[model samples]
Target: MDRLIQILKDPLLIAALAILVLLGAGELLSPGFARGDQIVRLLTVAAILGIVAAGQNLVVLGGREGIDLSVGAVISLGAVIAGNVMSGNDAAILPAVAAAAGAGFLVGIVNGLGVTVVRIPPLVMTLGMMGVLQGALVVLSRGVPSGNAAPALMAFVNQPFVLGIPGILFVWAAIAVLMAFVLRRTAFGWSIYAIGSNERAAVLTGLAAGRIRTILYGLSGLFAGVTGVCVIGYTGNSFISVGDQYVLPSVIAVVIGGTSLAGGSGSYTGTILGAIALVLLQSVLTTLQMEFWSRQVIFGATLLVLMLLYGRQARLRV
Candidate 1:
């Protein structure tokens, strides 16, 4: 009984259990919904969201009300930039990736400056940055989607590469491993936690809280940009709104994965399970023919409930 109680207290375990329950419900609702191939497909979709949430995770972990409202916008911009750069040429893939990542990083740096140097609240700064990116995308695209994903890019993302798992899953797995290592074993990672847990004390201890937080925002943008590249690859084309749907889901994934909205306590492992659970839930709802707005309502409700249950803690001292 004690062992079981201990497991239940772990957020990662809870998220894993939620995934199982979601999968079971899906199987019951749709006979083949839980089939191996189908689950793999759902996981492929989840991998994309997980990558975006990677950035969100870093930002949220840095505290100071850190949340990147501009991730979706950055993703859209990155996709557009990548699509144009790739132009269906496999040889140009590397260049396209560099361009996408660089653009996103630059934008993220600006956001960090706004939040730290200018003293703008993270919410307002990121929200305004989102608007700015959207406008830039509109002007760049001239109201029409342009550029094609290279055939090889598409295959890399959607086709099985090893052990029948899609290649994108491999990418996500690598990212997950890297994130876990960074958060658990690195000095930078420790600094993030220290700042988030108590910024005033962290600063007094000589940690460069402002600089670290700025880098966190930059990393968030960089991740979003990479996700945009993956998004274009997955869809085989670039659309203005390809990434818009992911904005809220990314944040939700981080929060539900047990990351404190108050900041400083969470794991990428939990986020991974949270991402899977969310994807499974979305798959189940889609199978049930839930309307778009209805699904969004459920997403919002789920986030709110999770916030109350797991994230309603004392705000960190700034």
Candidate 2:
């Protein structure tokens, strides 16, 4: 009984259970809610969001009000560049994807420099960066992005392998495993947590807090870049505002996964489940044929309630 209670008390497990319950309820309202194929499809969509949230998770763990507001813009820019560069050609795929990721890395470096060297607050710096990317994308694309998603890119992301699991799922799993190992078993990861938990103390103890933070931001940007390519693949095209839908949801997923907004503590495992839950929520909403505005309201309200619940839980644990 004690073990069961402890399991129930775990926020990540609770979130997963909630997803199951919602699926059950959805099944009652609509048949085939939990069909195997549907679940796979749902997970595939969630995997993209999860990939983006992974980066956000790292930044949150970097502490000092660390948050990457430019992710959506980065995604947009990456997709635009990839689309233009690839032009639907299989031959151009690798180089185009590489270019997109490289651009994202550059953006990440700039963001890191702004926060670490210029001493700007993360929120302000990233927001300014977001606006800059958005404007720059407009100028570069001249308002309309050309070219379709490369066939090769789409096929690779959508490919099925190893007992019918999606290639994208494998990609997400690899990233999740890598991040979990880094956070749990690495000196750098330890420094990240230490700095986030207490920056002054960490610095005094000889942790390179600034360098770690810069690296975290760079990783976040890299993930955003990959997410952009996924978005383009899924949609078969790129356009302005292509990634705007992800910004808030990525944050929500991280928070719902039990990552403290104040930073210092989080888990990629929790975030994976959180991403699943959010995607399931979207499926439920869509099943009900809810309007877009209603979905947004519910999303916001749900996030608030989850925050309150977890906040109270944290206090009780303390």
Q: Which candidate ranks first by lDDT, i.e. highest?
A: 1
Q: Give one digit per residue, the lDDT tens place, for model 1 in 1-318.
A: 999988787778888888999999999998988898998899999999999899999999998879999999999999999999999999999899999999899989999999999989999999999998888888889979988899999988998888999889999999999999999999999999999889989999999998999999999999999999999999989978888999999988998899998778888888888899999999999989999999999999999999887864755546
The local distance difference test score of each candidate is 0.91, 0.86
List the candidates' TM-scores in order.
0.97, 0.93
Tell me the deviation in Å of residue 155 in model 2. Answer: 1.8
Tens-place lDDT digits, model 2, residues 99-150? 8888888899899989999999899999999999989888877888656788
* Lowest-sum lDDT 10-residue window in model 1: 309-318
Q: For each predicted model, how many residue pairs clash, with residues at least 3 apart or on different chains?
A: 0, 0
Error of 2 at 290 (Å): 1.2
Q: RMSD (Cα, Å) of candidate 1?
A: 1.2
Off by over 4 Å in 2: 1-7, 311-318
- Model 1 shows how many backbone clashes? 0
